[model samples]
Target chain A: MLKIEGLRVELPGFALQDIHLEIANGDYFVLVGPSASGKTVLLETIAGMHRVSTGHIWLDQRDITGLEPERRQLGMVYQDCALFPHLSVAENIAFGLKVRGRPPSDIARQQERLVRLLDIGPLLARRTTRLSGGERQKVALARALMTDPEVLLLDEPLGALDPQTRENVREEIIKLHTELGLTIIHVTHDFEEAVAMGQNIAVIGAGAIRQVGPADEIFRHPDSEFVARFTMAVNVFPGRTEVGPAGTSTFVVADARLLTRSTVEGPCWAAIRPDSIQLVATSSEAGPDNRFTGQISRIINKGSVVEVTVDLPPAMTCLLTRHGFDQLDLAVGRPVCLVVPPAAVHLFQD
Target chain B: MSKHPGSQLRGKSRGGGQSLNWVFTLLGMLILLFILVPLFKMVFLSNKQALGQALLDPQTLSSIGLTIYAALIATAIGFVLGVPLAYLFARREFPGKGILEGLIDLPIVVPHSAAGIALLFVFGSNFLVGRGFKAVGIQFIDSLAGIVIAMLFVSVPILITSAKESFRKVDVRLEKVARTLGASPWQAFARVTFPLAWRSILAGSLMMWARGMSEFGAVIILAYHPTVAPILVYQRFETYGLAQAIPVAAIMIMISALVFIGVQTLLRRRDAGA
Candidate 1:
């Protein structure tokens, strides 16, 4: 297990304030944030490159905050695949082990195991300069894993590869995760990578983590407007609480209002993923549900889905599959109805 | 149809621009020949019979041997000290890095005689550094040791700048990765930076060595007693005119050229090892 309590670091544009996180022994944690949001700094700090201004990092119940990188037994793979150009692939994989004073006999066996496991057996004798991008990234990964580090940190591990290569590398990482069950902290600005790799996701912004939970929970229920906007929740608006039957709820701006899902009664903001919104043709629809009348302002093609930006009474935008859009024959100025259930509304303190 | 417009223009411009390339090429070759022909002439016109006698002469062989030995010593001194300084200059960005870099390049830009004079002042009997070293029973004036120091003064910049350029060409990310991979700072540098930049560093050392071997003005100014090869050549020229001096000059040229080519080939092999 790895835990950081009240982590703080001062950076040029941002300051990490009272940040906290926990990762189980085998959990794959993803730290997602915008560029220059101190994401890399935070990783480097945990890696022992940056000294924390305040806080303690506990690994497996031992405080290793003051330990150097080598002593901390933490492995890091950079975005650029920092392989030593002078060393052969085999030597690079054996570097950490040899540095730790491991016997040469033991190192040879370990190196062979890692080389075969990473599928870099053919590249063992080859110099690092000859490896492809994916090949280099694998070698870097294998090198880091050879040390048997307590936690493996990946900084945009697949950010440099082409689209097709990224998919293959992503699968390789997933396999590594399943086999090793290593505590992993992967950082990237990419949302899809977060969904694919992270069991737990921390939505970070500026410096502080705005929200943290299971990947599905954080996406289905963000804690702030920043996260909602970052996660492509395009239907956020200024809201207020009003008493209703049984209890109270929040309302979004349009000529119409939205139903609140939570019971906490205060002025709060709400976010809903684009896919949560359901759209239908306006045909005197009289259903016992949340609905809003609108005219389709535009139909934006987004690969497999068509995002319909509408000028409703509430001025809403919702995402629908291409099949749905084609069935509805969505066009500009076409009248439509939007339905958002209470369960889809995510509310946070204003 | 565009029927090779470029080819047509090429034909039209043949009389004017075509001759321009030929003219420049001839000028460049003339510059090359003008520089090299005299060197070739020195060897061709050398009296091998007299040179045989001169080679047997104690004074002549001693001077040539002194030149070769002094260059070896100067190269050793620079290799020991200049390389680390160059590496630091290339990698670090301290407050005074620019000033230090300028100081290293100053010797390369200054004339050899001026450098000899500067060294004389600093390592002279009365100056602080000179006095301090003299107190330790070391001296740098009119001695074989002085010749080595003077040669080093003129050629140290070549080694520093070349080694620094090689170090700078190596990516810093490689070093950072080594750190994360559990190698301490020294281990990281020895295993990575030094090896990768080894070829360029060797090339630079050879350049400085050759520069030191050919140095004349500095040796004359600082240490005229222990005559080096160039000083002997100068002495023969002044006394017996060009005939006697030409053979010694030819000998110096042949030896330095062979060493330069050998070093270049060795460096190429080192690069291939990478």
Candidate 2:
């Protein structure tokens, strides 16, 4: 287990404040954030590159806050895979073991195992500078793993690869994690990657962590407006909530009424995922939930899904499957009824 | 539409193209001839027998050997001291860093005679450093150590500046990765940073060695007895005039050219292999 308590790092023009996190052993944690959000700084601090202004890092019942990077036993892979260009693939993979003064036979054994595992046997003699992006990343991973570090810190490992290569490497990382049972902390900006790989996700923005929870819960029920928007929650609005009967609340947002499960009153923010808002024709209105009629103002086709914007009192965006969109024959200026279930509307105190 | 401005310029120049080409060629040839003429004249005027005699002379041969040896020692010292300082300057930020960098290049702009005088005050037999060395039975005045120190004082800036540039080209992230891979700071520098920057460091050493070989003013002030090649040439010129001095000077030039070509070829081969 690794724990960070009250971690704060100050850099010029940026600062990470009051970061508290706990990762169980063998857990796959993903840190998701926007660009320039201090994600990399936090990762580097954890890897012992930056000194924390105030914090204590505990790893497996030991306080390692003051340990040097090499003594900390944490391996890191950068986005660019900072491999030693002067060394060939085999030498690069053997670097960590050599640095630790491991026996030559042991180093050779580990090198061979990693080469076979990563399927980089043919590249053993090739210079690191000559490897492709994917090949370089694999060698970097192999090099980092050669020392058997307790935890692996990956800083946007797939951020530098094309789509096809990214998918392949993502699977490779998952396979390695399962086979080795090593604790992994991956940082990325893509929401899909976070959901696909992260068991638990931490959303960071503006030098502070907005929320941390299971990937599904954080995506479906965000705790703040920032988290909701960052997680692709398209229909978020500032509103006033009124406590109705029996612990139910009605939110008045831009002259539209939305029923939510929360009983909080006064000013608040209400959000619903784009995929949660249902579109129906005006003539076939469903049972009364929280329904509003509006004209379809825009239809944006995004490959597998279509994004539809509704011109209600306050415009709301909804994502629909291509088949659903085709069935409804949706077009610009068509009047439609948007049905948002009360349970799907998440309320946050503003 | 009005004629394009670019076409107008081209049209204006069209009539003068032939004369412009001739003028350019003439000026280019003039600069080439200015470099080639003196070199050709020196070789042509030196008697073949005198050239052979100068090459075989024990005094001339020893002087040339001493010059190369002292320069090599100075370059070695520069490599030992300057490389770390260059890497430090490249990777760290501190107060007065800019001024310190400027000071590294100060030796190049100062007059060599003045530089020699400055060295005399600090490294002379009576000075603190010289006396300290003398207590250990080592002498700087009129010694090979004095010659090397003089050469090093005048030529070390080339090594430091070139090394700093090379270190700058190496990404700091590579060193960080090495450190995270169970390597200590010293190990990271030795394993990753030094190898990556070796080519530039070698180039800088070559330049400093060449500069030290050609150094005359400072070495003459500090140690005149050792009789490096340049001082020997000056002595020959003073005693026997241009006729005797020409052959020795030509020999020195030829030696320097050969070494320069050899180093260039080695660097080319290394680059190709890499």
What tens-digit string does per-residue lDDT give for candidate 2 at A1-350? 99999999988789999999999999999999999998988888888888789988999998888888899998999999998888988898999989999999999999889889999999999998899989988999999999998999999999999999998899999999999998999999988899999999999999898899999999888888899899999888898998766666898888688888876679988888888888887555534468888889999999999999998878989999999899999899999999898888888874
TM-score of each: 0.87, 0.90
Q: How does residue A120 of candidate 1 score in lDDT?
A: 86
lDDT of 1 by residue, B54-114 (tens): 8888988998898888998999999999999999998876898998889888887888898
lDDT of 1 by residue, A1-350 (tens): 88999999875556788889988999999999989777887888888776688999999998978887767888889998888877889888898988778999989888888777788899989998898889989999999998888899999999999998898889888888888888889999987789878999998888888888999887887778888888878888767656678675746555656776766456777787778888888664634366777788887899899889878655678988888888887789878888888788777774
Model 2 C-alpha lDDT per residue in residues B72-190, reported as the tens digit of each score:
99999999999999998999888999999999999899988778778988888789987888889878778999899999999999999989998998999898899889989999999
For model 2 chain B, where is the 10-residue window of minimal lDDT?
B265-274
Best candidate, DockQ-wise?
2
Scored against the native two-chain complex, candidate 2 gets a DockQ of: 0.76
Residue B151 lDDT in model 1? Answer: 88
Task: After the best TM-score superposition of candidate 2, give how far the Cα of residue A156 lies from its true spot, in angstroms.
Answer: 1.1
* lDDT winner: 2
Candidate 2 docking class = medium
